[model samples]
Target: MSTTPLEAGIIPLVDAAPLIIAREIGFAEEEGLDLRLHRAPSWSSLRDMLALGQIDAAHMLSAMPVAMALGLGGFAERIDVLSVLSVNGNVIGCSLDLAARMRAAGYGFDFVDATAAGRALIAAAGDTPRIGVPFPFSMHAELLYHWLGALGVQAPQALRVVTVPPPLMAQAMAAGEIDAFCVGAPWGSTAVEDGVGELLLPTTAIRAFAPEKVLAVRHTWAEAEPDLTRRLMRAVWRAGRWLDQEDNCLTASEILARPDYLNVSSEVVERSLTGRLVISPRGDLRSVPNYLVFFRGAAAYPWRSQAALMAHSLAARSGLDRAAAVKAARSIFRTDLYRQNLRDLGAEMPGATDKVEGAMRDPTAVASEAGHLILEPDAFFDGFIFDPTGDE
Candidate 1:
């Protein structure tokens, strides 16, 4: 079915930085399609917009696509999750009050030893700690959940879970509404610089190169627009490669901080993008690369292991079926789309499928099974509320 070129509209956000940069920077144009970028109010707002066909696709949360597939979200008439937008760009932050007390009680940048670090942080909190997350079905919430659980503290018992918008996280912390927050770029970096909070931990240390977000579209829409989907993925893939360029980091940072995008200061965006995070007043901003990965570095290969880990996470949290959970998750996390994107750009695929660990101590391995990349799911979780109708 042929349609008007550039007829599709895409919604944007901080996580959508790459897609925005891809368009503003020409990767979208190279695909020979006209693109429209729209800003959404929130995740559910964007999901509803995409599901209603108000937009062709979206810069979405990694779990958003799968959540829709499993009817874990609104108007859950299944949708096809096409590709990853970026990876491992999130950070765990704590307020100055909490940070000081933790330091006074002996908790520092101990990324590898997540278990002990979480216990100490929680212990530093005199009573129930109020932590903010961007959304209910976000990597922020899941990562925080797993990391805190490492200390034998479940999200419900150990602390209070608060839903603060990404943009408002820093302000909420500064106001003492939240003691800590798990969030993606700019905001986390913004908090630390504004003297409201401290970025005590990088998510990479918690979940090495974890899948952070993706491009999602209605499954029926994807089936009908196969060529468009391929073209779209290729365009974003090229954009990813461009963003990964060291020199382009500054330029990309400028694009993300525009009022139409993250709506924060460019200085704040650069802090996260250029690997310079402001820890405190007296010291320098620590280097954290690929903070806001877009193109290939973050968006390039859709690791099967990343998909499996999301399943393990959702299963562990919600008690969904692990095997069935794996199937449903794999249905949306499309590596096939990723391959097309990489091929058009003439980029060689990653030499080998590597094992990635999520927030859990367990490792997720990737292997070829039945011509598909198979990632190992967690065995410990057997209880989750899964609707079988969505299972493929």
Candidate 2:
């Protein structure tokens, strides 16, 4: 049996587990794919690699495809999101100096409660808070804007936004280049390990069930190679399902900790997998359920509403027309492709392609083909629900 060789780009982060697992755990091979993983230095480089046909697919920021579709980010290539790879794995942390200031100002670092955390972050950050995100068009930036803007900070205007790659975030903090950062684990956990920063809040505290990363490919490539696309999606989907199982955490962490992959300690990687984080140098432990969701509760489903929300944010910030942006962005999340690939594999899929973003407050059962799809809580901290159809 001849396997099709496919190259994919990824950044070194815990959320890259699905791609790593698909290769390491034999899922990709099972699907007749010779999956080759390339670790890029940053999100921008990875995005460009995919754009330039350097890689067939990528573990990409969810907002990247949408931002590209909206004509932001200076990339004109169309990138389609095949499926969501991981959901809600980001952490907002502050430098040791900022943490001390926040602590002295009576901020408890509760590691939840976005509203209180936002207020305290604002007060402690003074007039203009210097914050770091992996990319300007990433969910980290969008959530930061949404979370802080809701809490009376003007955001992006009243804040100094810095673009630091995930691997370099801890170094940026240690050097006092960034006052705070919102990044994916185990990079955030790495900062704590390095004694440079303390975790303040998981992005889940801002918006539960945010689409963090997607399995993305060039739109032209997906269309040209439908069979390969289908095979790749199924392979990664299987890996995500396996990752969500509690028993696989140890093995998955070990695989991800290899030097070829994330290259961090398995213990550090496992913390993100299990949602148990050591937030501070003093070792304050916080357990957050569903912190880095891989597959449960339709986490891998490519919801167009999620894309619309990201598009809405990008448009509002970039001066693009909201309606046009949403329309373009929603099409990029390829739910049709997801169904075409994974439906026969007993993958439970939501019957609807889009939903009111941030509306679910609990594990609510929705209409699905399998009749057992219960969506996890997806409410925004401020209780804002975005109706993709009702953009007025």
Q: Which candidate wins on lDDT?
A: 2
> How many clashes show up in model 2?
0
lDDT of 1 by residue, 166-284 (tens): 87998998888988888887677667667788777777555545567777778888789888888777777777777778897788778888777777777777667665667665454
lDDT of 2 at 304: 94
> For residues 1-392, what per-residue lDDT tens digits would candidate 2 score against the true structure?
67899999998888999999999999999999999999998788899999999999999999889989988776799999999999998999999888888889998888888998888888888878989999988899999999988887886688888999877899988888999999988888888888899999999999998999999999999999999999999999999999988999999999999998877789998998999999999999999988999999999999999998899888988888999999999999999999989999999989999999889889899999989999999999999889988836
Q: Name the best candidate (by TM-score).
A: 2
Model 1: lDDT of residue 293: 57
Query: What C-alpha lDDT, on a 0 to 100 scale, does residue 98 get in candidate 1?
Result: 85
Error of 1 at 214 (Å): 0.6
TM-score of each model, paired residue for residue: 0.83, 0.98
Q: Candidate 2: what lDDT?
A: 0.91
Error of 2 at 34 (Å): 0.7
Off by over 4 Å in 2: none
Which segments of model 1 are wrong by more than 4 Å?
1-14, 109-113, 155-159, 281-283, 295-299, 350-392
Per-residue lDDT of 88 in model 2:
94
Residue 390, model 1: Cα distance from true site in angstroms: 22
